[model samples]
Target: MNNEKVTVTLELNKDEARALAQFVKRTSHSDCEDKATSQNEAYLMMDGVNAVMKSLAEEGISPR
Candidate 1:
């Protein structure tokens, strides 16, 4: 596994940011593992979130 920094910038309101932060915290806490597993889980979550955003966009909901 490669240890690198990937930056993601989202334009979200305070509520959205808080919600996302809570979601991430909950997911991360659900498992106890090393840093690699934690990072992989985070990536998987971001991927899922991106897919949802794309689907929403296709349904005419602008992601931005």
Candidate 2:
């Protein structure tokens, strides 16, 4: 990974922020690490969340 970092900003309402925080709280780590392979689960999760945010933005919809 590169030694670069970013600070993203979002203007979410209290309810929306709380909901996202709750979702993150409920997320569980997967045990996909066997002796031979290690999975990049965080990347998978980030991709999914990014896709959802992009879709909502394209549709001009707010997540409930």
Candidate 3:
């Protein structure tokens, strides 16, 4: 696979930017600084949403 670099600009509040920087520092220690890192994070968030939805469904609550 060819490795090319892409640039993405994000506008974050000061607190959010600091949090993202801290997260990057922590995850980079585990060798997770790559394109797929954000994708993995997104999947993790989606999984949490799915779990919440499942619990709500069990309680007969509509999440519409």
Candidate 4:
């Protein structure tokens, strides 16, 4: 297999999406520095992604 990176898309319901949005806002405000908006938004997005992955791992879940 090639070492190329692939993007993974997430599909969340309305409630889930809303919760993630809230989480991002909260985390970004507390964890991010006084940097550019783009950097802060990226940090928020990665926070959400890490949260989902961690949740799945805790539940012994797989993407298969």
Q: Quick one: best lDDT, which candidate? A: 4
Residue range 1-64, candidate 4, lDDT tens digits: 2446556667776567566655643554335545436775666656555766565445444233
**Candidates 3 and 4: which is better by lDDT?**
4
Candidate 3: tens digits of C-alpha lDDT, residues 1-64? 2336444444566566455444433343124324235766655545444544454445444333
lDDT of 2: 0.52
* Each prediction's RMSD to truth: 10.4, 9.4, 16.2, 10.8
Clash pairs, model 2 backbone: none
Backbone collision count in every prediction? 0, 0, 0, 0
lDDT of each: 0.52, 0.52, 0.46, 0.55
Q: What is the lDDT of candidate 1?
A: 0.52
Candidate 3 lowest-lDDT run of ten? 27-36
Model 3, residue 21: distance off in Å is 31
Q: What TM-score against the true fold does each predicted structure earn?
A: 0.42, 0.48, 0.40, 0.39
* Cα-based RMSD of candidate 3: 16.2
- Sort the predicted structures by TM-score, highest score first: 2, 1, 3, 4
**Residue 28 deviation, candidate 2, in Å?**
1.5
Best prediction by TM-score: 2
Residue pairs with backbone atoms closer than 3 Å in model 3 (clashes): none
Per residue, candidate 1 scores C-alpha lDDT tens digits across 1-64 of: 5556576555766567555554544444234233336766766656655654554454444423
